[model samples]
Target: MSKTANAGGHEGSAPHLHRLVLFSDAVFAIAITLLAIEIHPPEHWTSIADLFGQMGHKLWAYAVSFAVIGVYWISHRRIFARLRTANGVLDVLNLVVLGLIGLLPLVTELLWEHGGAAAIVYLGLVTAIGFALAALWGYAAFAGELTGPVHRGEALFTLARVAIAPGLMCGLIFFALNHAWGLILLALALGAFIAGGRYMRRQAEQAVEIDQPEEASA
Candidate 1:
């Protein structure tokens, strides 16, 4: 079945979604693996004490990077799950999003090695992905590529849900620019992101539920 309610007309569009999602999954897997390769064993290993002492930030950074990439992958999966039909534009847009995701490993390592402005770049890239995500949702809804019927209000709700990531990332970047404790602020920012995501997803779900007709709901 198509992910959207009214994607019947666009079923014949070029580039099957199967291929696109497969390619996207490959990219995501590679990026996640690269995150581990970025982390190296402590050099001149001696004992548990030396190992623990040497691999301080690297461990923390790897954990954080892993979490970050995982979040992106989950979001990407959800979006594609909703994809009813694929056309050239939709496939290209998805590829663009994948391209940005592919850069996360490199940027994550850079952020770990150099913290002054790399955080800004990293968050900025995430924000771009957020925008691209918003764009994808907007296009699918507007182009009638979604599986079910999507009203304008419901579409806006979907947009808001995906838009939360970049919006908060942008705010965090600004927070870091003016504040001395950028690192500490990141903890707060991440917490806020989690909270916001939960709230937005709930809102979108409610909207979709309300819009889905009783007969069509089944």
Candidate 2:
């Protein structure tokens, strides 16, 4: 009886998981679309050049927010790919992450309009999202809710993966205090995150292939 209960709890139901993933994908799509709407063209400009010049900062903010949301979506997809089951705790954490994502549009528009500490609020939203990711991932990983092909340490790597952006954001906040180049650091930190995540995923997949050489060969 204990063994049966254990199996039921660990595996849950795949259909439920599929529905959750579908819902998540739809929300992410909507969030990305909303981000683009943050960049509004001015109703009046002296010339086309003036219009483009005024748009420069808004365009930059839009680009940053767009990339940030896309990264989170990709990370979410990657995490779900190796998930074996979801528990109540995971569900709550997932909702918190999504809630933070939904706030990006507000923060994006506010920062483009307000500047100043608005930048920090934007980055702080990202940091909260990162911490949520870490908690959700840690629960799934330590609870043995990861799939079979996941390497022994890959989930731990994921914890590290989601943590990097927030850690770098702290540096961004420092730079903002010292030099006002925080936006530049934001771009750089995101670039490093995308590059590093790809590398880590590739390495993990290769390790899995090596471990299951017979299946790999077949």
Candidate 3:
């Protein structure tokens, strides 16, 4: 994407892109609300006891998926925050990303009920969503569709980091005869957040280095 300012020297497409961002936000908010409906609180003591016994596993899976989608939304907001404008490609990409994300409830429910290979499949679906998101961010960064001085390195780092958990978890499903491997996947998801946060911090530090020469010269 051309970094040059428009002839009038203002960001060309803010109004349109800003609306897109808001719309995407609304959709995400709705989707997250929907995710909560899948929890199915235990109504009877027997059911409650049974659920509590299995709740640890189901809860962990739900939390993992919940946080996974939440993180993606957070990163996407940051990425789009840099946009100069939105284009047809970006709109389509956004739809695709949201479409994939919209599948989370079904996938989470499948994991909660079936609890073996289905759990792995759910993770695989999430991984696919992550891959699509990474693609979307890469497109925005390279296209200069971002609204600000976005750090491409930081963007790429975030994408790669977000992708690791679901990808690895999908692989672990084969040995997940029970929820054994699913727990492993949850641990990896936590690691992904820790690693991504650290990477983003490093990126921020490097961003400061760009102003060093100007500071020294002054």
Candidate 4:
């Protein structure tokens, strides 16, 4: 009787888990699509140079927004990949993450329009998203049933991955204060992201190695 009940419960949770991941994926897709839609070509340009010059900043902003959204989407996928089940609190946190993601396009527009002055808002939004993601991961990790056995190193590394955006953005905030800093901070942010990614990958590899020996001994 207990075995039957356990089996039934697992069956029921499977669909719920699938739906949660699907819904999150849909939100990510829409947010990234909206980013491109926010960019428009110049209405009246005398020449190719004029067209390129006019659209330059918008194009740059679009690229930055696209990359940021793309990274979060990948991170989201990683989080859900380990998840075995979802709870009400997890659902709420997921919604919070999605809500922040949905706002990226508007923030991107703001950054393009007002330049450095608007960067604080943009950075702040990104920072919030980062922290939200970290919180979501933290909750899942704490609730043992929501995920399979999470490796200690992997958990710490995942936290670092989510922290990269907020940490770097906070530093960039100081630079964003000066209008003259312009795209330099954007370039620096991207560079830091790349470096951070490499570091995280190494950490993940080490985590797997650490886990494997323990599992084998067990």
Candidate 5:
């Protein structure tokens, strides 16, 4: 049970991480609900098919955006689980990340309304903010060395997982020049990230094992 707060601004009595998680849950719920609102009801039978057909892109955009956001949240949780405490910098960075996440509904709406070009911009913005959060986490972990000596490799692996996002988004943006093909690339990137995370976890475990043996011998 760790307590944290925005040490730079607040009295440091409140737990910032818990607050962030609760706030994040609220925003994500609202954002997801907003996506359903984007679907317009058919005015008549004749327009029903047209409305439904036109919504394909919007639905796809919503699904993709939601999935990416979910992935980021999961990754954030995994990284933070290793920490014994949170610092002001990490709190600020988490706020920034959550702030960007709170904008997902609007961005998703924009992509649904405007299409691929808009999606590229929205995706870039989201990924950049996530990258910043990851950087801040890495910095905090390095600065505090909060995790025990055996857990340093876990920190590095977590950092590597975070680094993959911006790079993947950059590649997807470049490929999205082909529109639908680009969206496919984005999906592929997500798949690759899932696989990469599993691999990194195994590597981290191996590193822990190696370090343990040396420590034992000493």
Candidate 6:
């Protein structure tokens, strides 16, 4: 009887986690679709040059928003792949991340319509999303029986990967506050993100080396 109950519990928990992932995926899909829907072609363009010029802002906004949302989708997949189960708190945290993701299209529109002046608002939303994702990962990894054994180095690397770009972008955007300089800040943020990734990867490797000996003996 006890064995049957244990098997039933395990079966039930997996479906719960599966349902959560499916719902999150649907939200991501809708958000990306909304972004593309926001880009409408110019109604009256005489030449290729005129068409390109008119569509430039919309195209740029769509590209950036697509890339950002794509990254979060990948990160979300990675984080959930590491989990073994979910609790109420984990469910709430997942929703928080999804909720922030759902706002990207609106912010992308703001960027398209207002240019650099709207960047702070756009990047601020991104920053919030990044931090919320980090928090969700942290909670799942550390708060009870949600995730399996997470390596220390890997955890640090994951946090750095998910959090650093938006944080840097947000800080830089505050100073630039325009479309042209916003591109410059993005380049800077990418460079810094790469450097931070390398540093975190090295830390993770060292952690693995340190743990290997202890793990072998045990």
TM of each candidate vs. truth: 0.71, 0.75, 0.72, 0.77, 0.74, 0.80
Residues 1-218, candidate 4, lDDT per residue (tens digit)? 22222342444557777888899989889988988888888789999999989988888778778878887888889988887776667778899999999999999899889877887798888888998998998877764347776666667668766856654754454456465584588677778767766776787778889889999999
> What is each predicted model's overall lDDT from 0 to 1?
0.70, 0.74, 0.70, 0.78, 0.67, 0.80
lDDT of 2 at 212: 86
The order of the candidates by TM-score, greatest first, is 6, 4, 2, 5, 3, 1
Model 3, span 90-164: residue lDDT tens: 677889988988888788778778877586687678788878877777776765344455565676676686566
TM-score between candidate 1 and the true structure: 0.71
Alpha-carbon shift of residue 78 in model 5 (angstroms): 1.2
lDDT of 1 by residue, 40-97 (tens): 8865988998897777666655665666667667877877776667665676678788
Q: Residue 80 in model 5: shift from native, Å?
A: 2.1
**Which lDDT value does model 4 have at 19?**
87
Give per-residue CA lDDT, model 6, range 1-218, as digits (tens).
22322332444667878998999999999999999998888999999999989998888778778878888999899899987776667778889999999999999999999987888898889989999999988777765446766666668768866875655755555455445677786787788767876777687678779889999999
Alpha-carbon RMSD, candidate 1 = 5.1
Best by TM-score: 6
Give the count of colliding residue pairs in each prediction: 7, 0, 7, 0, 1, 1
lDDT-wise, the better of 2 and 4 is 4
Q: What is the lDDT of residue 53 in candidate 5?
A: 79
State which candidate, 5 or 6, has the greater TM-score: 6
Give candidate 1's error at residue 126 in angstroms: 1.0
How many clashes (backbone atoms < 3 Å, residues ≥3 apart in a chain or on different chains) does model 6 have? 1
**Which of 3 and 6 is the better model by lDDT?**
6
TM-score of 2: 0.75
Residue 216 alpha-carbon offset, candidate 5, angstroms:
3.9
Error of 2 at 53 (Å): 1.7
